[model samples]
Target: MAGILSLVWFVGSVLITPFLMILLCIVFLASIGKSLGVRRLYVKLLLIIFEFGRANIETAQKGSNAEDTSEEDEEHIEEISPLNSNATNDIKHLKTPNGLKKPNNGYVPNGNSVISRDDKLILVPEPPFTMHKTDETTDLSEAKDKCKDYDLCNIFDYLKAGMESIIEDQVTSRFEAEELKNWNLLIRTNRRYEFISWKLTVMWVCGFFVRYFFLFPLRVTICFFGVWWLTLCTALVGYVKEGDFKQKLNKYVSVMCFGILSNAISSVITYHNEENKPKSGICVANHTSPIDVLILMCDNCYSLIGQSHGGFLGILQRALARASPHIWFERSEVRDRHAVANKLKEHVSNPKNPPILIFPEGTCINNTSVMQFKKGSFEVGSVIYPVAIKYDPRFGDAFWNSSKYSMMQYLYMMMTSWAIVCDVWYLPPMQQNEGESAIDFANRVKSVIAKQGGLVDLVWDGQLKRTKPKKEWRERQQEEFSKRLKVE
Candidate 1:
């Protein structure tokens, strides 16, 4: 019986202890929650008090604007504080950052600075210290009488006393500052987290599609959809990423259509040697917009060599590796210049992908003027085809907004615009000679385009300029030649 009782007691203690511990934990969490709630309430109350006090002070100042100075004097006395003359000299000697003298005179010294009988310097501790205007206007007897009553100076004293009170109130309300700091930090953290989440989601979704669906049949189908689908996809992505699709689309469509139209027009309008046909060469053009890619891709046989921005985009490029033959470049791959050059060389060498499209301008520029071309594309063994595209007068104003206009608004502007026009001039292809440098070749091509396309001023040679031949000289020369022939 004793053993059973002991065992029962032990069991009861073990079970009850855990329940009590859990209850204690519950109480601790509840207490913490209550404390935070009280702190939040306190901060809100303090803000309300500060706002109310500030408003009341402003209202009081306004109300006293019409009050008579004499009555104010009757209410309070003015205390005259002596200024130290030496302190004033010290302040005047102070220098500014630019080695200039201090603007305001320094504090008074020796407490010997005399106060005028009418003009009393009263120090009011409130913001924008107050000054009472007094002169011959106040009766001497009345001024002396008012100066004796300290209560007459109560207005200035009240202003001083209220200032200290306001400062103390502000100190008590510091919880508001803490709350605002915490709120801002929370918002910033949330925004960062949201962006990270969005990037992760995009990666996952894009990866899943490329890995599973973007295989043989699907890839072929995507290719067949042609420029329109590519444009739509690119526009959709730009819209999602930037929240502006219309302007980007417009710029894209305009540049692309211009290229196509220019090519078609040139085919009919331009004359060329049919027998000594221009060999297939890499077309190097200025890259003003992403639509430039589609324009080049219009020739289905021509493959693209693009630098891939990693992750899902890179994976997508890899999946279409055979079809597109893109040069997959990591963002960090810029550190390895040789690797990039080698990749470019390999892609350009492929016989199947002749005439690689290269944007030698390096970056997008306004369509008005062409930037200097980068020389990397010229180094490729293939002949270089220089093409100059000029937009029609109407679409020349289409520049990407770096200021007030957002992407979406820009897109809308483009969609509303009518037809876009452009001129495409294809210069003759250039072959690399044994001793010719890339820079020399580039300059030579640039000169040809500038001359033939009216890009530079034309000058005529003196020998080519002819004046009308003298009729008498011509007749005399003919008669002499006939006499010489008779003698022979």
Candidate 2:
């Protein structure tokens, strides 16, 4: 019963569709003709349709007679061979070697059947195609409009011929402009527009206002309160407990709190860590923002090693130390680079401290690409664990462009968007090859993280960021201007 109704419905639709289309077409043509002041629109539309039909007909007839072999055209013809009909009946299965699924008795597959024979089976290539030439014509009404504007001057010139010379200079400029207004000569195949500085300035100003109004309050409410909470908990725990166990416990608590803080900003956070990997190995990860530390800490307990930046970010770093043994080194103490390396080794060597965490990319990258690892981190040569950090910019960019945005500004940008999210992969510990220099080992580990993190591997050494390029315009080099210097 349903089938009969469906068939009736289908037939009724088919019969009524053409009539409805015809009515719509008449109304459309009447409107077009009314606007154009003529009923000649049909002629123009039909000509366009005919031109399209002719092009399609030419293309369909391109290679239809490819195999013709008349004696007059024999010079272009080549010998042809037909494929054997019995070849498929003799096909063999690959599993025959294991005696599990035998090929059809006495039949075997021949892979050579797929190979094309150029001499014996020469197929004629299709003829080159040409596009239909257009019959388009430009309207001349604009030129008439220009003449109307000039007609007023003509009235004055006829009254006094000497008066025309006085205004000739003004008239000539307008005439020259009008003459080439519709010309297509010296065609611009491509356009190269130089930077418009004013537009950029306007965008920056607008962004600042947006951040201040929309995102700043939410970020401060979350980050400011969250930091104080972490500090209070860590201070309470750090002072009361005294052993290596206490520090590990503090790390575990810090990781949990920070992880929750991370979730507050991001919609999703994906963490992948190898179960059997050691808990206290030195961790080297890609640097995107300060949040990289928070995100990873949420995944596992790790003691952070970094330099303190001035402003709110610096204060957050100091507070983090109360939670666990976080090492904050100063670059000005170049004499202490070696000392810091020793401390990192000591932390990893000790049984009580959480694993040492270091972002080899000293500065924050936008997370679209990776920066080079500091060779100093690799010098420790302990069982090195590489952790890849990646963020989805769909919610908010994870990069901290310190030059343009302070920590306060960046945090607001992050929270105002959808939740901040990241993927953390604790890759296998890199096995240092014999005679491998510290630089090579660091690069090798860096490559593993970049691959696992799904990021572009860069050759830039982040450690050199302090001295080279001067720090005045560092954000440009990191994001926009250094595009040419990027490694594939």
- Top candidate (lDDT): 2
Residue-wise C-alpha lDDT for candidate 2, range 1-488, written one tens digit per residue: 99999999998798567545643443343223222322234334434533443343333333343345234233322221223333222222121111111222321211112122222101121111111123345334433344333234433322332332232321112111111111111111121111113343354355446445534444445455566767777777767658867865676667555643553363355567666244776878888777777777665777777666677767667777776777877767545877888888888787677778787877776565566677888887687888887765433556676767776677666665434556778787776788999989988988888888876566655544445534644564234323322333
Assess every candidate by TM-score.
0.35, 0.51
Q: Which pairs of residues have clashing backbones in candidate 2?
A: 92-109, 265-419, 265-420, 266-419, 266-420, 267-419
Residues 90-173 of candidate 1 have per-residue lDDT tens digits of 333221011122221221111112222112112222211122335547555444444443343435544554443343221112
| lDDT (Cα atoms) of all candidates against the true structure | 0.40, 0.53
